[model samples]
Target: MSHIFPRHSAQSYPVAVGGEGCYLIDDTGKRYLDGSGGAAVSCLGHGDPDVTEAIKAQLDQLAFAHTGFFTSAPAEALADLLVEHAPDGLDRVYLVSGGSEAAEAAIKLARQYWVEKGAPSRSRLIARRQSYHGNTIGALSAGGNEWRRAQFGPLLLNVSHIAPCYEYRLREAGESAEAYGLRAANALEEEILRLGPDTVMAFMAEPVVGATAGAVTAAPGYFKRIREICDTYGVLLILDEVMCGMGRTGSLFACEQDGVAPDIVCIAKGLGAGYQPIGAMLCTAQIYDVIAAGSGFFQHGHTYLGHPAAAAGGLAVVSAILQRGLLPRVQEKGDALHARLMEQFKQHPNIGDIRGRGLFRGIEIVEDRESKAPFDPSRRIAANIKKAAFEAGLICYPMSGTIDGKHGDHVLLAPPFIISDDQLDELTDKLSQALNAVI
Candidate 1:
């Protein structure tokens, strides 16, 4: 009956009519709490006046500018602000419309940087398993989610997938977290050597694995070892922070907590919150210098790159995050949320694990807690849980194929940084109801 094309045609969809704070209102007036920040996008929650005002002001002043010949003030200012707050050596920003675009740009930039640097043989990419980069072609190829990549295998370029630093499932019995981290990181080295390091252009991963692995954080020292491996092999480190960055992880940049910075980093979602769709691929000065000194052009372009209004929204959103002191608040709320989850679900039959940092957390479901055995894929536990959550006026991210391409389930929760204590309790209560219904 609707002219609009939906994501899943077989399933009816809710028309989100309005949003305020951490709740999204449907046409029927059901207010669903944004438990996962709508795939971890809405950092400041919905309808923040500051961000909307910035967008309106930018549209009134300069609505459109073709970046092929011109650069706008908002774009420049946004880039400057991002670089100012970015990890050391990450000195440039490439603005795009969303997460996929950012990932695509990062991939191309990494390859192009090598080409310009006279290392054109560096064409292969290495990423960790159970990671989700973006949906675009290049990004998809770089991502290691087998389920997402299966149908597109023929079209996808070859990429090496090393074992992810997922400690809960991957760590051996009696292994310390720190030791397990180093072992997990060494997988990259093994793959790089197997493929020949010079043939590899970049090693991409999320600081905290999102969507596919359900907010899995790396073991301690995992990324530090990863950084060292990249440096050793002359490979570029590309951190995909699409879902976990922008104060979602109690830090402006998720990599900040890891105490390491990547050569190129992709960020989106929370950057513009839900105010505007904007994402950026940030790189070090060295990478930028190599291309600038060689070709003077990066040889990549998107018509919507650096659109003024989007940049304005991103600028305003980030400004509010910093100026209003939301970073520390995320940390506080995150700790509270984590503690509450542990208190409530530590002994839950279906709740196997509760893990993550800041407001981003994951509750892995299991058939047996002692075995960490996942519910059968045919059971569709994740899908049913989602339906139950939605019906109960809760909006959380529940995903299948959490352990591999088809074995596990997890509910990822990343609420707005501004969520209050009462809202959080509501989230937990609703989630419990959903679990009770399905699990």
Candidate 2:
């Protein structure tokens, strides 16, 4: 009877009528624990009064403003706050509506930066296989998730894809983790050389691979080597933190733990914490200065760029993250959650790996733990797990085609920063039940 088009036309969905903290209530009053934070978007959890009030106040003062003619106070303030806490050398913020737009802007900016520097041929982009950037044309071209790109292959750009820093699948039997990490990162250098370094503009990747790869963190020393390669080849290192940044991975920025800063970083999801649709693309002042000194125009824009109300909500969410001492809590609680997962699934036959940082964690489902073999794609393991978990009144992110975009599955858990110990227990119990029923 609904006129709206649904994400899955064949499936009817429960109406989310209300939410409180870590739980969402349906019209029939079924409460689902928000274990995955609704695709890791609701970091502060649902119905936070502070974020709501900020948006409301902004709407009262000024609901919207076009960035062409003017910039709003909220937008300026939000950008300032983001840059204040961002990684070293990243001094500029370009606000957008969400993750896709942020990534689209980052790609265009990277291309523009090279052009302004008089290197117009530096238009190629290299990203990791099994990685996801976003869904727009440029962003999708940069992503290496084959499933998402299969139907749109002809429309995608000619972006190169290197091997991912996936230790579990790619590491040799006797290689040390550190050695494997270095080897994984060196793939970027090889690809850049093969393609001619002069033609490479940027290398894009998620600090902690999300969605397609299920919170896959890079091996130790991996990002450091990547930074070195990009530096040597004059290729800009662009880290897409759209799903893993904004304190989702224990740090304010996910790359902070990796001990390297990127030339440009994109963030969303947790920025406005689902209170408002907002995202930002931040870059080094050096890059900004290049365009500033040249054309003084980036030649890119969106209607909702630097939207006032969204900016206000993002400012409040980020302020709460810093002011209310939630970063440390995310770490502390993340450790606790990881420990519980390990203890619960240690002897389980099908659970292959438990990995990730902060509240972002992934449980890789395998046919056999000894061989680390994935379930057959025809089994639809991830899809069934998602269905079972939803029926069990728990919301989690389980994605199929995790390995090479075809033959693996993983369940990603990204609970809210405010999830209580009791709620953690409930989440684990529900997830366990779902796994048992499906696996």
Candidate 3:
């Protein structure tokens, strides 16, 4: 018996011993194609020499440095590189260990910014339903995934959740995608008015909703209008790009495709590409200036805020994404993957919608395509599909509670940028097998 505390206490899992390009090897030597990049973290696939070398070199020089006392070169360089390519107005970076830390920091920073700006009343937050930010208390409260928040309701801070800009189910029958997006975006304004704009500090959302909603992109003009509303209300827009940023969504920053730059942004997952755990929260110059001019400290921290080796790994991963021309490649390959998924499942009776951008795609499963009704929660459709995919030698991300917190199912596909055409076919073939075995 193992002494480790597993994610699922009752379920047993195969031991992952090693990984290559896009496949993970189990203890028994079974090669499972990594269809989801292990929750969209390994963008460069299992092993990359460049990132490893950088981390190793940094460790040899200096493995750790507490931020309370000093800042290291790797941390400084990483911050500079991130800001250089970040969206306009985002001029500062706060490095952390992972997505949860990033989200926590973003929340605190938003609140503090308002306080420093003489708006302490702006302490409330607003987010979208069916969105997943991170797992920390503050992040969890900001996230609208009900299933994840149910048990912790007593401890969570109060947050207003508006309807998600999900076109598949939320858009009316005759509404155009663009019109539906505007209507959806207006919900934020309504909520802000209901809560009073001055009482709200930030509006947080994933650029491409991940995990909970499974790669759900906003309808056209949704984010643009959202940005406008934030500006009008003096509310900060915080984009959580934890699972969809980096090069996973074709663009280095997912918000770029939406043509909107947020006042603050949280990024992780693909930032370090599974080489080292790293995430960052970036803010605009205006937000930074207010705090700098007021207290000179943001008043939030973590022990590993800027670990030298983790910073080195993130620096290398980001450099590889930019220098190797992976951004365009992600776009090209994303189109290919989307086309292949459509070709394979578009006509199927059970597959309701196949959507996403870049290498990040999602397949919503429905009992009836016309009604878009989900499989019964008791059926455990997502869990079974995941098991079947794993058994078929493919590693895919399937999740329950897609529509609400308990009604729908979806499989999120986020393969590495280096995935080849042949591998794409392999992925589709194995996914078909899994679906056949399940639904």
Candidate 4:
């Protein structure tokens, strides 16, 4: 009976009428705890007063201002704050409406940067398998998630994919973490050489792989090696932090934990905490300078590139996170949540892995703990778990195709930064019950 088209056509969904703190209320007055923050977007939880106020103030003053003619205060201020805290050498910001836009912009910018630097042949992009950048054609092309790219393969640009730094599945026995990391990182070097290094424009990756792999973090020295590989080939390194950034992983930027800096970074999702749609692509001074000196303008734009309302929401969210010291709080809560999961599920025969950083954690479900074999994709275990959890008045992010965009299942937990210990306990209890019922 609903006119609005939903993601899944056949399934009936509850009407989300309102939100308060970490809970969403349906029209029938049922309350569901937002355990995954609606795909890890709502970091400050729902109905935050500060973010609400900021949006209201922006609307009162001005709502939309096209970026072609002018830039609003909120947009300027947000860019300044982001640049100030960004990794070394990244001195510019390009705002967009969402994660896919930001990722697309990064790709275009990388291409243009090389062109401006007189390397027009550098057009190829190399990303890791089992990685996801975004859903748009360009971003989707950059991503290695096979299922998403399968039907749209012809529309996507030609991009090469290498092995992901997935230690759990790819690491060989008798191999040290560092050794496996080096071996995995070497894949990029091999790909670059095979592609003819000069023809490669960039190497893109998620510091901690999100959706496609379920909050998978890179091995200890993996990124350091990636940085070296990019530098060796003069290839730009673009880190897609749309899902893992913005303090989801205990740090303001996930790359901080890896001890490596990328040439360009894309961030979204938690940037505006779901209050408004906002995403940004930040780049190093060198890349900016190349474009500035050559064309004086990056050849790209969208109508709602820097809407004042979205900028205000993002600025306020960042302000609230810093003012309330939520970054450190995420670390504390993340530790507690991990410990609770381990204590509860370590002996559970189907739980294969409990791993992640900060509030962003993933529980990989397997058929046999001894073999770490995934549940049959035909079982649709992740979908069943999600539906069961929602029916039980809980909202968790569960996804299938964890192994190769077709097999494996995982539940990604990215509770709000404001979540309390009690809520964490509730999340675990609901999740445990859901998994039990499904498996």
Q: What TM-score do all the candidates reach, one by one?
A: 0.99, 0.99, 0.99, 0.99
lDDT for each residue of candidate 1 in 1-439, tens digit (9 for 90 to 100): 9998888889999888999989899999889899999999988888898899999999999988989989999999999999999999999999999999999999999999999989899999999889999988899998888999999999997888988888889999999999999999999999999999889999999999899988899999999999999999999999999999999998899999999989999999999897888999999999999988998998888899999999999999999999999999999999999988998899999898999999999999999999999999999999999999999999999999999878999999999999999998999998999999897
Clashes of 2: 0
Tens-place lDDT digits, model 4, residues 394-423: 899998899889999999999999998899
lDDT tens per residue, model 3, 49-158: 99999999999999998999999999999999999999999999999999999999999999999999999999999999999988999999999999999999999999
Per-residue CA lDDT of model 2 for 338-372, tens digit only, reads: 98898888789999999999999999999999999
Task: Output the lDDT of residue 101, model 1.
Answer: 95
C-alpha lDDT values of all predictions: 0.93, 0.95, 0.95, 0.94
Clashing pairs in 4: none
Residue pairs clashing in model 3 are none
lDDT of 3 at 161: 98
TM-score of 3: 0.99
Candidate 4 CA-lDDT value:
0.94
Runs with alpha carbons beyond 4 Å of true place in candidate 3: none
- Compared with the true structure, the alpha-carbon lDDT of candidate 2 equals 0.95
174: Cα error in model 1, Å: 0.9
Worst 10 residues of 3 by lDDT: 430-439
